[model samples]
Target: MMQHLIRFRVFLFAALMLVLTAPAAQSLAQIASPYDVRLAYVWQNTVTLADGDGVPLEQTGPSFAFGQGARLVWTADGSRLYIALDNGLYETGGQGGPAVQVPGIFGRTLTFTHDTGVLYYLETTAPQDEEPGIVSFPLREANTALMSGGTGKLAGYFGRFASGTTRANLTFAAALYARDGGLLGPGRPTLWPSYGSNLFGTCCFPDPGLGIFTLGTESYSVWDATFMPGAAATNTTQTYLAGPTTNGVIRIIDLITGGTRDYAIQIAGGLGTIERVAWSPDDTMLYFISRYNPTTPLMLNVETRFPVDTSSADVTLYRLNLVTSTIEQLAWRADVYGISSLAATNEYVFATVVDSNAALINAFNTQQVAASLPSSDALLAPYMPQTHLWRVAVDGSSVADVRDDVWGLAARPIR
Candidate 1:
């Protein structure tokens, strides 16, 4: 009886998504591209990058209240910047103008396929315990709604994926969808058939050319679904797992051939757990941070594979070789305070350091692969306070190449 009820609810959710999406899909065809980066952070605002100078080309904001998380992607041409905020989806011109908001969602988590501009996100209606599912918002419908605030619904039904249970399991599941859209259409959620444990920390590379790849607590998995612009669905699946129960092994999966790769870093001592994983824009390397010993009040540790360990007596930055899967110690500072956040691009790596009362942005050049740290004054600058977003040049030209009030910034070539 329980199983039957669950299936019934899943079917209902699927129906809702289909009804909402069909019209939007039919009305819209192609999306323009060459988009700048879209940023959403804790303060519930959005911003866009204008040029390569690392400045806020244009700014838009206070769009929604509960924007817990967001992912920004440009269309293939870079003309439109799409932002998926918690419960709300929006897009704006590359130069930053009034953002168009897409309605009809009640949850967080957003992702987009750059090729087709087929927007994909997760949607959940009331009943906190019920599993949330994947939904599609056609670019045409979304743009129309954004421009005119038309009566048309912004979301279309895609399908439902599985979610995690406890906080740990929840982390894995959240990680899976962190970057990549959550698993669409379902059998048991990924990582469920085996461990019966909830998958946490989900992230994906949802390119049609690559299919979809996800990372979970025990391992990383890939699906066979090809997310072509206007095609019918194909078989969805979890292809592989980076096994043998270990903690803090941040794995990056390739969506094209279902390849599973692991980065074996002792991220967080055996304490709290690794929380964030970010991929470099070029998609060759990954950067992750782990908060360790959270149970102990005095000794809280924040560890990063980017070659720094904030929890130790000395703060150090490390260089990681993606092709070789190696780590080399680069720089060390005795008076380092705490790492607030980390961001990287193909050209440079930016680390936000928070000390006594001042916060700073540290920049590193990826071109210089050797493990020698740049001078502190040369690589970092005092970040203006109350600003969550900062932009830096990928070419290592000047730290002030561009400046904007963004909650988050990605220093990479936007496609």
Candidate 2:
């Protein structure tokens, strides 16, 4: 209503460094995804449906637990189901029903708008102004009350949206600690020049306006995000995307040639932080999820296996190729160090790894016996990694698992 209360106070100060660093015990060895949990795990239970390499599709599919907000999104064509429990956001179908509850939508990083079912959550009503309110709901059926100026037409469309009568606009390569970050397609609000992280109290995921961004450092808490898919109408920028950009820093906005392309991420083991991206409904490839912070020195003085070493990380899944711009490396899970979630379907590219290698290789070997323990709290070794659900092949060729205790994977969009 006043542009959603000024888009909820500029998404409450660009999500005040991610709602004041929400880590109520999440860091399960850095599992940052399942496409960042947007698919909501679809009412989980260990679903492992694979094909495209790591063969194992729908092995019952369901198994989740990560605190009040257990998601499972779906709706664009797969029927219906928008689960986000902790007692809020619910709706079901696709082979099950009566879960209702979509009124007033609750917290979590939900997103949708492809064919326009309109939903964009992150609300806490009024938690003593700890700031949290950016709601938008509409699944039809006389369930109204998501009005924020009639023509946002579902901000930046996410899954399958490109048939056009004027589309292709979402802008923002800016980052002075982001604000209004960048409005997704439709009109006005295209500001730039806020290059790279410098945030203060991060809780996460904000810097999504299609030209990707997920930059986080909190002085070295390290996280390099940058996502894609904002109603991509192919051409006008680089239809088909990926992130965590670094080949020469970033900036690539061109809403139909408003112009701006500093591009230079020619890739190699130097690209970091574009943790997830998807495309290939003929937009020409671009299945991604790169991330880094490696120090590999395995055995005899081990470097990183997360026995309490600050920047422990690793994750890969590449396939660029916007017509030969080339970049392929299909799958590589170094026993999972981090990667919360990712999903991109045209032919599969879903992920949810957080491996933590049996909770950081143990039996007097973790941190190599906690460096002969003497109590740094026993040299710290509190492992908690377990969340798998992979599927690869956007042309990089198969990489299966399909589902092995998954609590993240919501890919059934396409409109």
Candidate 3:
């Protein structure tokens, strides 16, 4: 039952890895961007590079067969991209280059540090009695693995911070760790699964000249706990970290001073829970996805408390202005599951929305047809929903379907 629940949550976020006919490739000149922005995404089981407009610039040869836990990350300079697939991990040069498989390395949940050029990830294969540990590999020197000393199901690197202040630690699960695997301090225990990890570094960082590294994790008490990295045990303190609670409110901790700021989400009737959040590059605005209300009675261990599960049609995307504390709807699509993936830039916000209506129909048909077969005849696989990747203008002026059947997406750092 535990395995099934874990797999089900993953299936809800990842769409099927289908082989679809690719549209004719277009020249890079077809897109518009000031920094010549590029995006790395998993499209129809293949690793593809696209321009800012979501037009395919190049389709790397390597593809993910299962597309489960498939993730993509770009180097700070946008010269190289690291891709994690079901079979193994692969790397590709910026454009028009064949993806070379990174031998002896296959894992899930990836995070990259710009300062050290090291990629930290959780090992997929751990001893049965032992928990999976976080591992790191220097990008400049590949195939060499170093023990990061801590065990976590998810790992994240907070690379963006104000000048004169730095985040030298990697957030693994609900704790902070130095690059060498030393335990810095502990965060909230509820920071697992999706919403917690999604908002790791979305907002809240040490102010310039604070000379401190900050970390935060979601909690059930309506407010998330913030921590200042310390030797051995973390010293608890409030700092910049913000997200929605189950109570239809979003709260943030000040980065410089220790205080809390609460912004109530304007909703009509039922409670609103913001699931995922992304901060614009300028730090002036925030983009988030929300659900109307979650009334499903799920088991404690299997359900995420922060953003309760709701119907696909009840989800809406919103943006908030930090200066005026105002909220506005950015986009919303009916008959689709909540936005599973989100990333932002100065010009546009990218989101992955799964077609829930189609997924439900597929699930029903598969279950009904398989009911007649013996349990040993075949394993029942969860049907995944169709996924669409959209690039919406930062100002809410326009939205475009950059690609269909995209499971995971990562926008290259343009700064």
Candidate 4:
């Protein structure tokens, strides 16, 4: 029952195909501030060189950007890239060249084994129905292997998080699995029935969600859950966040004993919606990004949060003390619209700031994003918005800009 309950929302393949079939949108222009900002991105269906800072490296990509939703995955040593696209898994030449395409195949969430160059993808196909399972192929292969079978639902790629919370379970390759469209195939093997040793990473970083269901026009939260990575004794204790529905409450859950504790967060500033959440490396504090109201005026001359996109000035980064259950504002910039995609390591809280006016950029580049996209799903914006990378310490000190002119950024997952 525990395994069944946990297998609710795993692959999310429909989300992938839906995005693949969606129409193209706009692109964000590279920031030209004389400052170098580089990021690996799929442009015109080719694997282009991505630098952490915004700078063009000696790399080539496809003649046309992928015309659908896809994921760009790098080899362990960053020598090559496997691009999952509408056609199939496309390979890239790190130094810039035409992308190699495998005809008649489509994959979602391309990921690499923690220490190996082996590439795996969430493959779903028709007729067989169950064929849309987890499949893997090396850079040299045109043929693929069905790593695991599925009940025609989308699943997760086999990999670990950058924080070192390893995912080593060959049986359950998905670090955390859940269902969205509906309850997926029950008989599909959730654990590695055959290839248990073929998995990689730190093992498994499993997560449990508070059971939520909708009835008629109303919504009900029967449970709450949240998990943190820590020592062995602390790792099994997953806390579930509960709700005021109006404000919000943190529900700490115990994975081993199925026990729980409730703590109401006295959110500073004003009540806001939580988009992302992470914990301090020490497991003492919880951090989140929210469109929280400001209790006081923002500091001047600092970077402005790009609120123009949303037309609301309510994005704030907050931290909560686990022992005291007290929440406080860690940082905010009224100048920028809002904080997005928050991730915290022991050393820094990484976040993306919507700091630029995407509308004022070149129309040609915007057309590239729009024309190249498969559709205008919420995953990809209509126009690429100008974004910058920022990080701060857990104590909210050493706040600094890592790169500017970056429209999107992702930390290499395998450490």
Candidate 5:
């Protein structure tokens, strides 16, 4: 009888443990990782964030007016959304609350430090023709109306000298400022030297191990730049990498060691120029769009439509293997439009297209490239007749989904 009782006790204990652990395991399976990508969008004035499944997670106010040149910046906690426009800054909490206008901006790209919660903004008071500078505001004071009332020049320009001119006759060189107005280093100006040229777009990734990745325009090249840990000075070394530019090739300089590398892409039929370069989430591969004769006339001879091979106008997405220095064409569909502004996550890549009456978001997965070629249903979805921001997983499982009715789209891993 005691042996039977012991057996029953052991069985009961085993059953009890299984019952206790099953719910926790199922709960974990259902809880998505924070790193799992969710997209945010702004329609009219309201902003919303949606999960990979296209389900609405959160939505903000309808009073938040985002006109031209408006961009969204999610707070470090992902609980607040900061909408930066050419006029001012508007902020809305995550739970679809009322968006309040924060006073200090007069048209600049704002950068927020995830570490200190300090807000930095580039301030340029120079005439449209003169050199520009940058400035910063403490996070606590950022909400004030007169946050940038004082002209604090974080960096200044050193005039460029002409061949026959004295120092007095030299023109002030154009200046470029960090998106966030933080002191770059301990130089006399406390700012990094900027050539003052504008580039297509800016991407800022703050790394706890590596300092930061600042690319676009006169800032830094993606192919080069050895980012050091906890250091402000980029190594002067550089390498020249061949790029797909109008000239067929452009120099890629490594900001760190100042080393240069030469890279060339063999485009069939004719040489093409690169429209944009997008990096994978893991930085293992690079996706670039190249077009042949982009300026070729699309409509010819006033009335009659030109029988043109629009397929040639199609932007080809090529995956570059950074390790082997090899390039492969992934997709070549003529129906997709505006292939320039493409964003990639771990699961998929999203590209926007325009048809006769509506805009469509197309998705391509890295893993299922062979299967997705020629026709992609995710790309040919129920199109919306309006403009909006769309995102997709790079992995290909999650379909393309719309985020908001915003123009420019920017995303970073939620570390």
Candidate 6:
């Protein structure tokens, strides 16, 4: 009897130890995901953080009045959402968290460096007194509780700023600002395309670790050029990716090795004209939206489709395998007006698609006319293309509408 009782006591002790120590073991293991919000976007002048299903996890007010230029980004850990507005920059705590302005931030474009914990922004020819350049601030300063650390200037006289982990690294247009001081040397040549207007901020999409940036031609002539920052302006071995040329040619350029490959992607009925492109999180695939029309040139401006003329166009989403060179048509939105933007996470590729119909077109035209007037404060409503947020599985399995009347989209960066 005593032997059985002793065994029972030993078992009871072991059970109690597990119950007391299990929480610590779980805490030490890395969290698969720290937060619930997996995407961030702007709709109706509000910035929203959403989950995989497009459910609103947290949101900030109609703060972005002129949200056309506003940039929304989340911290690497997904703890905060930074909304870059024309007026200033602000941050939120992700669950309907009140926004607190990051003081002294006056910039147009903003990008966060995950590894460095730095928030870099483009200080345009703004406020007229301060010198225009690339300025940065530690993200801890943006925290509502600890808004202490001030700003610092990194580089001078740049048209754009972007953070990269691949060979291209940190690119400040016409400037070379390395993450570590002087790693790329001073006065390095830039890859800014001369063929098109300096729309580098919009027309270019950077691969996370691929050392490649996909480019598109927006209302401009398609041209070829070879250039990469931190290298000679032109390398003899370097080949350039032609702009969104005729016949849906997708160019993948290697910034690290100075090589280029062109893929002429096509759909069932005809050729595809690329508008916007996005890179998957793993950097193995690229998601792009193109207009498929065999007969007429349907490449209207991706933005500002004034005098809307997309009646005969069919906008489709396609996934191009970087490893296999295989093109897969994931989702098809036929008879649509246009797709303004494309973004991707590990699970889905989200697009902001505009609906095409005759009546909405007329109202859009009226808004365009009113927009021209300096005194007009008109809202783009009742005819705003019936815009909605859509997500298609990365594996080309399914597609669904996540939200309505949404414009800008971004996938939360996972650290």
What is the lDDT, from 0 to 100, of the residue 289 in candidate 5? 57
Per-model lDDT:
0.32, 0.38, 0.44, 0.37, 0.34, 0.45
Across residues 1-415, which tens digit of lDDT does each residue of candidate 2 receive?
0121112111112223233233222111221322212233422332323323333322222232222124455554555556554344556554442355655534333434433244443222221221243222211111125643232222221111112211121111111001111121121111111223221111221323332222231122222223232211222122212332323333333332334443455675566665555555454555666666554522333433323322235667877665666677787766344554566666667776645433334533644455444212223323323355677766657677765544345554432
Off by over 4 Å in 3: 1-34, 94-96, 127-242, 245-264, 267-271, 293-311, 357-384, 400-402
The per-residue C-alpha lDDT of model 1 at residue 211 equals 22
Worst 10 residues of 1 by lDDT: 1-10
lDDT of 1: 0.32
My TM-score estimates for the predictions, one after another, are 0.45, 0.27, 0.58, 0.42, 0.49, 0.56
Off by over 4 Å in 2: 1-38, 42-76, 80-282, 289-294, 297-313, 316-335, 338-341, 344-351, 366-382, 386-406
Q: How far does residue 14 in candidate 1 sit from its true spot (Å)?
A: 41
List model 5 lDDT by residue over 1-415, tens digit each: 0010000001112222232222211111121445443444443334544444434444453233211234466654555667765556777654445577775553443444442144544442331222233111111113233355443323222111111111011000100001111111110011121222211112112211111223222232232223211112111110111233223443343433445454565667754545445556455556665554433323322221111112224556667766677777766434322332444555555443322221211112222223232221222223222233444444333444454333333333332
Model 6, clash count? 0
Predicted structure 6, TM vs. truth: 0.56
Indicate the residue-level lDDT of 95 in model 4. Answer: 40
Q: Could you give the C-alpha RMSD of every candidate to the true structure, in order shown?
A: 16.2, 22.2, 11.9, 14.9, 20.5, 19.3
Better of 3 and 5 by lDDT: 3
Candidate 6 C-alpha lDDT tens digits along 123-214? 43331221243221111113234335455443323322233211221111100111111121221112222222221222111211111122
Please write out the lDDT profile of model 3 over residues 1-415, one tens digit for every residue. 0010011112111222223334434343423443554676766656777766666667775754342445565665666777755356678876547788776454433445443244444342331111133121111122225533234323223222223222121111101011111111111111111212222221122210111112234111212333221101100111244555434566564544446577776656643545556666556677876655323312222221122122344566788897898878877655544455566766788877654433323433445433343211222233333567878888778988777767456666554
Better candidate number, 3 or 5, judged by TM-score: 3
Error of 4 at 92 (Å): 13
Tell me the lDDT of model 4 at 404: 45
For residue 72, model 6's alpha carbon misses the true position, in angstroms, by 1.3
